[model samples]
Target: MTTSSAPPVAPAPETASTKDPATRPRRRGRTGKPPSALLSRAGVTALLALATLYTLLPLTWLLLSSTKSREDLFGTNGFAPGDEMHLAENLRHLFTADDGIYLRWVLNTVAYAGVGSLLASVFSVAAGYAFDKLTFPGKERLFSLVLLGVMVPGTAMAIPLYLLAAEAGLVNTFWSVFVPGLVFPFGVYLARVFSAAYVPDEVLEAARMDGASEFRAFCRIALPMLAPGFVTIFLFQFTQIWNSFFLPLVMLSDQDLYPVNLGLYVWYSSALSQGHPEDYLLAVVGSLVSVAPLIAVFLMLQRFWKSGMTAGAIK
Candidate 1:
């Protein structure tokens, strides 16, 4: 009896496999509520399709209409091709009308948009660089004032600009339009944003430490880095100046000085008032031609523009 006591048995420790099924915690799998109708992939694709259609509709109409005769332009459906293609005839008429004033308008547009955009980009970049990297008194206040200018519509500023031009004896002259195009407040804002995003302080510091002057550093180092931004600013300013009608309308009386947009308007107005169907055709063709440069510029610089837009988006 003294030797026969059984040793106490130890219970086995519980493990996952040994646990009761009902007592084990449920794991989370990939399960959730469905996305909303509007946010669904199908919905997003549909919206993009609609937007593309909306944007291309007018351009499609313009292309078809340009191929039509004056009679077909009014008679046929906007999207339909004309019975007879008259595009060449229309272009010839457009170029020859009013002693080839359309060509003058095209050149004027080129000069105003091209040169003005370039100059504006340069000035804006310089000012923006100064605002971002260089410190001075009243910098924030000055920038705030510039931001205010961006809020003001260009149309609202036209009258004041006209008054200033008149005071300077520059109204109805090329300089009136050209000078105003140079001072793009929005471009300044864009340049500052681009400078902050693209141009690094350390790079400038390195250049400066090497005894490079501020202006030299800007030209040699900062400017090349800001190339994409420069092109972005140029394209924006170009489009604005190219399509600018109100400013030129207020500032210019001479037909020779008209940009393509304003010139087209004048032709359309005269066509309506004078009962000239040919002028209507000319306007249409001129409009088609007017779009070419914009398309070309965008196509050429789109790579730079894309890079500029995505700069600093991630970091």
Candidate 2:
């Protein structure tokens, strides 16, 4: 009985790394430190600094140049601050000239870009959702036309849009510029991609089972899923419409309805061609004023914009 009791012994268990060193991950250094990064820290910092300088150079020039009067603009050094910093005077002249038409131009830009982009986002999302979830004849054909539209430059459509506006008696009115910015084909395409990727079919089916109409189901169940996509499309359309020039040039004749870009262009042109070189400073200041809203908008909505762009890539 004593001999039998001594017969049983347990063997030690082999852990993963001990069993297979080749398959196991490499360990950290003796000090438990990670390996060197791809880029040296100092080298990476220097690269970023150079990039920052490259981007800021022009803006820096503009800032310094705006501070100069017309005389200083030509007479003094271009990059350095002039002796008489006339930024306040330049701004005053900018708003006061042409009976304060610059304010009207700014307001017109808001209507054309801000309001138009909002409407475009809604239409895009709705059309995209319908194209994805609903089955109808000619749906693919219609969507193909949309894809075709994206390849055509907005400039190429200006004459045709102008012709259409003339037919509708909308020429030279706010509606001329406001309406065109609202019809972005690429936005609809992007919304479709986001819809198919984000909105779940099973949830929509359940909403249908709960006696919800198609519109109600979309409004209640799907729109919230598409909100991020809307923000992305809105921002894109807003910037496009905001920076637009030729479309408004061809569509509108009333300077009172000009967007800031077109208005500054007229000023810069008149200043250069008409010998009122003093207005050049006004043009520079207006440019800075125009850029401020875009910067503010990006800063405010960048959180949603970043998330929206990356959402469909994951699922």
Candidate 3:
């Protein structure tokens, strides 16, 4: 091969047109097969519709039942309108019955829930802020105790609280209900989480460097930022105090000091035991009236509430 006279030719690089169809890489695009039908848009929409129906059912029944007279209440369908509307008449009877004790109960409920929730929110936020920003001895241990409190149900604590109230000569008094409502362990936890998520440490440091006292920084800086959390805590505590029955039942024997929930219970019991259908009607209407404030409060603060609820999940 006397030096293989001609140089060997190199192989040509593959091109798209020259590549074999079986060897070519497939481009990423839609396939002929469709995705699984599970969790599709239609399925999600149906699930939401079902949830909405479930939630609205009771409220719808309550609204319809509130308009019915005693006869219509038992005679007609629960979800349908009555033969005649007795809403105005029912409200009149509700407010006037028992010398308008219902109004007093309403006021008591407002006071207990409003004042207690406000104070509780303030205290919780302050404690939570301290827990988050300020370091102290036994901080984790103290917080562990708070977490422990969150694990304990309110109903379980009712007996112990009643005993403490009795010991302090506070039973059957407003303080019995109002004082206990102020200690919200879960609210404290919620506020702490909110503080950690919402309040920036650098901002506090800047305030401190500018000669602001700790308390001043908290009030003027941290508080405004924590407004949503404050509203969240207030609403939670308000709803709890509003719906509380067992605690009031254990603490209060005087009907005059009763909250709306306990007062309505008394009316229902009287109706059942004393054969007073009018009392039953009063209880029904009173229940509807009692729910209105909660609805109004939620509607008003929903923006803040929604923001507060989602704050921890973001960061």
Candidate 4:
């Protein structure tokens, strides 16, 4: 061992930079991207920040404006708070002005958006799961029809829907709005994507082999996996229904049946056409009220929605 240890060690060749640390290039981070790529990433971040500001600016104005009276709203800068906060006054005015019909509109909106979205999600999930996992005659043809429905703008179909609703005597009722939304073609398409991506055919087959009926297997097994998809479809339809102005405008004449959007529109029009500016404030406050539910729903469901959106990204 002593003899082996005595073997000569070769002298290590030294780089010039190694000897003088100050002369050496600083080590970069392990980010494999080049400087241009880094700059591009920074640029993209800045662009997104600007876009976010652009989008939120009007909403910020709306929020600030809602707190002011009609007088202060017009007098003050859009982004600035008014002389006095009258949020409570505005809300009270909103509820009481139309004999509490605004509250009815809110309730009607909840019903249409909530129930219609739920039904749409269910129908979408069922149809999508069937289209992906089942083999039946006219499958592609039916899916093509659904795709065609998606391509046809809902607004273009509004007249057709109104005509059909008239034929069925469902016009001017919640059912008129509710029924049309339940067959959401976009929801079906999205559901198909999710079903294909998330639900495994092998698992369904296994469940079938284990003495489960198709519906039973779907409910007990596949449905749980489709949770994210359901949430996504629900949120989409909910937003659509909540923001739907034209359809409800066409369908319902009754103030009692009006959703928040249509009712708010009526107020906004009255404010403009009739020169009662306070009604404008009522419309603004009602907007806040209408938006609150959607915000709440989004915040509540975002976890599932985001996970659903990203789940298939890698796999």
Cα TM-score per model = 0.86, 0.80, 0.85, 0.85
Question: What TM-score should be assigned to candidate 1?
Answer: 0.86
| Candidate 4 lDDT over residue span 1-315, tens digit each | 355557799998999988998999776657954456536878889888999999888778778888888778888788888544488788778889868999988998899889989988999999999998889999999999999998998899889999999999999988999888888999899989988888877778888999999999889877888999999899999999889988998999988999988888888999899998878888888887778898999999889865653344333
Residue 282's lDDT within candidate 4 is: 86
lDDT of 1 by residue, 206-246 (tens): 88899999999999888888888899889999999999999
Global Cα RMSD, each model: 6.1, 6.9, 6.0, 5.4
lDDT ranking, best first = 3, 1, 2, 4
lDDT of each candidate versus the true structure:
0.88, 0.87, 0.89, 0.86
Off by over 4 Å in 4: 1-39, 306-315
User: In model 4, what lDDT does residue 166 have?
Assistant: 98
Model 2 stretches astray by more than 4 angstroms: 1-54, 82-85, 308-315
lDDT by residue (1-315, candidate 2, tens digit) is: 355456667888988877997978888878897766637688789889999999888788788887888887888887978544388888788889889999899999999999999999999999999999999999999999999999999999999999999999999998999999889899999999989978888879888999999999989878888888888899999999999999988977789889999999998999889988867777888997888888888888878754643245334
How many angstroms is residue 255 displaced in model 4 relative to the true structure, after the best TM-score fit? 1.1
Name the weakest run of 10 consecutive residues (lDDT summed) in model 3. Answer: 306-315
Q: How close to the true structure is residue 29 of candidate 1, measured as C-alpha lDDT?
A: 43
lDDT per residue for candidate 3 within 175-274, as digits (tens), equals: 9999999999999999999899888888899899999999999999889889999999999999999999999999998999999999999989999999
The regions of model 3 sitting more than 4 angstroms off are: 1-38, 83-85, 306-315
